[model samples]
Target: MELRYSPFDFTVHEDPYPFYARLREEAPVYHNEKDGFWALSRHADVLAAFRDDRRFSSRNGIRIEEPFWGPQAEQFFSFVAMDPPKHTRMRGLVNKAFTPRRIAALEPRLLEIARAHLEPLLEGEEFDLIDFAAKYPTDVISELVGVPESDREQVREISFAVMHAPEEGDGQMHEGSTDAMGALIGYYAQLTAERARRPQDDLLSGLLQVSENEDRLTPEEVIGVLVLLIGAGSETTMLLLGNAWHAAWKHPAERERAFAGRIEDWIEETLRYDPVSQSSPRTTTEDVELHGVTIPAGEKVLLLSGAANRDPRAFPDPDRFDLDRDTGGHLAFGNGRHHCLGAPLARLEARLALTELAATVADYEIDEAAAKRVHTSINRGFVSLPTRVTARR
Candidate 1:
């Protein structure tokens, strides 16, 4: 049976692992000439591609082959799509903004936010985790980035537009598409200017403080970083929490064990089982041959991190979602330099959210009919997951 892989296909979106497994075993260097791209689906190949930044670069926007965003769009995301030196400098400055201390300091508030959103629905009644999961993380991160409480909803709307643009728009740069992006950047730019005038105890002010030899990010770059932070930090985390809950609900034994004790294992196993980010786009800088297949330079090569995580060559009995399995080093978060910037914060949020779910809800019933998986170019998770939670005695 020949397997076909399409990024925009709903069937593929609903479940892509079986096809991904075939890509690993049959066509490790799978090429989709129709979509005009190539993909590396195995663990070794994808990891190598990530390490070989010289050959496979992120310079050309990381959303398949997308014309490397126009000048205006570039200003808002150039740092993400650039190679070292430029990437290094931008990352260094941005690191100061997203400091360990900053995230650590926010833990109390993070937990509080998680509970605040969760407490209202923990009465053992039927409620969709998706509804609450979507906004809690966004609210927490937006406040940290200095977004006004009044504007968080607007920020979230923009984030959703950005995440879905690949599917809704031309899948690449198009006129008027940057309007939402512009709104997001304009909002952050205003915040950035305000921070410059009067500093605040927030990420925006921290960015203002991070200077390298009198060098600083332009307002555009700061806006870029903030935009990326909210977009990357919100949807992925939201879906992750949802995916973890859905995964637990599928595995009763594991769910039972998780309820009895720790939920960290559940998070780990869920990430390995159903990652939010199925792949990360990387463009080939030059022609490359892998697993007896030749891929021309400039061809978009997606490191299918989601597929690689399930490779039986790297994992034992890959299909089984076992909590006891040592799922350490899974590429649920990408590998190499472009590894997820907000991984620690993501883990912390999931820990708190799942821990609360386990503590407050005795057990839950998933209405699979109402549950819908997110169908987008580069995202995966439940869009609507209605559940019936039994109140804890």
Candidate 2:
């Protein structure tokens, strides 16, 4: 069979479900010669890949393309690319801030932030949901992570530039990420220095205080943790808000059901039907066999999360958005050990954003023709989605 690459073709990005459905049937584990990578499209296969650490290693790195910063990129962003022991150690320190109770406590604050942005929209004729709705979660996450409100925009801008940087080159990709990353690293380093001088109650201070039997996180490790937390926590939430709203406007009935306090099902349905982040890459540590295909060691593997989420064998009427289907097993947050550490936080942000929007914005619609998509190998969301919304009774 000929190799099939998904992200390269703009047509596929436009409507990937049809092609994804075909992939589920023909090539659950697909090898694309064009990109020199393998893609897994079925839920079972993707989940298996996510769980099997020894066979499919993250050491070759998680990104599909080379890091813009060259070798340093791996050092700075290697948390996601690490295997057990190191993965466990790094994740343990950072995971403290994202506990269920902590995220649950954030709901009221998130709701307040959502309400604050939405109130101005009520008086205005129209506003961009991507600016307000999508931005709400970033603000909330920043606050939770101890980022000053004034610096949040700068942080988000840096993240946006790097996260949505074009796949075609690595020049601006490195420069932009390096500058933004420098700002973040400097901010955290200064913060850590201050904490050392005069400690306080915050996530950073808490991180500074954590010691793992003489394995405490170094300043560099602290920077890495903060970088990972801020970007992952904020960006994914923003995407979920944007993606969910886009899906709701596309399906009016689904929107109505969602507005009526019937959101859990619809949100999960939307995730399975149209997830924000599609694929995450992994590398093979050894030669692997899948359905008669031989994938050589040290090759890149892309786990098509969005494609697998909509696999027909797993979800009936996979292309259709049915608010009633069971979508709990979707790979929207990935699976197993490296599953999204902020899954609870991301879910809370989306649930609150979608539910609050449905309740407050009595009538709203996305400007389909004008809406733009942010193209990246990993993250998928909107660049701008001008939406018109009215206040509810």
Candidate 3:
């Protein structure tokens, strides 16, 4: 079957796996005329492209856009959309902040926030899980990363707007989306300066004090890192939580098993089954052969991480969300050097969020008809999820 996939398909918004499965099986390296990009779907092919930076560069950009945010998008400076030397140096500076120890340290605080958010929902009959469940990761990261309490609300708004820009662009830049992004930049700038003046015990402070010998990032680079850190840091994990919840609610027996100490496998299955980032974009640096298709230099390539995770050749019963299967080789986090730096943090957040949701609320069901799917060329998520939560208490 020839799969026809579009960024704006409502059918995909409902369930993109079937389309992904077809792509993996029939058209491992398929081209989309409308978008003018080749999509790599099979697990091995997708992983190769992600790892082979010499052939495929991140320079042009990482999204499927003909006229992306002309200048305001700011992804050019982001580590997500840069090539080596620059990508390496910038990533090194920020990597200091996301160290395993720091993420581990944030666990207690993350749990506290999770518990606080879940408290009100337990008392209510029904509520939006996206707002209450999927929404908390960024908020928690903002605090953990040292964005002040006063500016955190603006942080969430801008992060969401900038990250979830409508097809046109970030809503704020869209004539009248909001004044939040400007405020966020202003606050981040302040935080940046504050760290410079009086270095504290946090990531921002560390960025400010990065050694000159270690290849310092410019202030713009710093802002770009912060943008990726705050946005990428939370949005994808939030999707995982929301998507996993949707999955478990759809499969009650599996949901029960998840609640009963088998949650990690269920979470992995959810990621493999429905990843937040369905695809990542790359620009070819040289002529490359992808499954018999010749992609000339400068041609755009879409690494379909979601499709690869569900490729039958790579996974038995690819479409089935079975935790019993080995999900270790899945490319949900991409493969190779550009593999997500924040993945460990994302997993921790999901494990906590899912375990808590499963453990609490005696009965829960997703209001599928009422749920809203947030769409972007890169990330997939719920705009909102209205769910009825039956309290264990």
Clashes in each model (backbone N, CA, C under 3 Å)? 0, 0, 0
**Could you give the candidate ranking by lDDT, starting with the highest?**
1, 3, 2
> What TM-score would each prediction reach against the true structure?
0.94, 0.92, 0.92
Q: Write the per-residue lDDT of candidate 3 for residues 176-289, one digit (tens) a residue.
A: 223444555666777787777887777777776675475676666776677667667777888888888888888788777888888789888888887888888887878888
Clashing pairs in 3: none
lDDT of 2 at 40: 85
Pitting candidate 1 against candidate 2, the one with the higher TM-score is: 1
Span of ten consecutive residues with least summed lDDT in model 1 = 65-74
lDDT string, candidate 2, 169-247, tens digits: 3212445655666776777677667766776656676677787677677767777777776666766777777788888
Residue 280 error for model 2, in Å? 1.2
Q: 130, model 2: CA deviation in Å?
A: 0.6
Q: Global lDDT of each model?
A: 0.80, 0.73, 0.75
Candidate 1, residue 353: Cα displacement in angstroms equals: 1.1
TM-score of 2: 0.92
Write model 1 residue lDDT over 30-104, tens digit each, in one string: 888777668889888888888888898877655552543333334545567778988889888888778889998
User: RMSD of each candidate?
Assistant: 2.2, 2.4, 2.6
- What is the alpha-carbon RMSD of candidate 2 to the true structure? 2.4
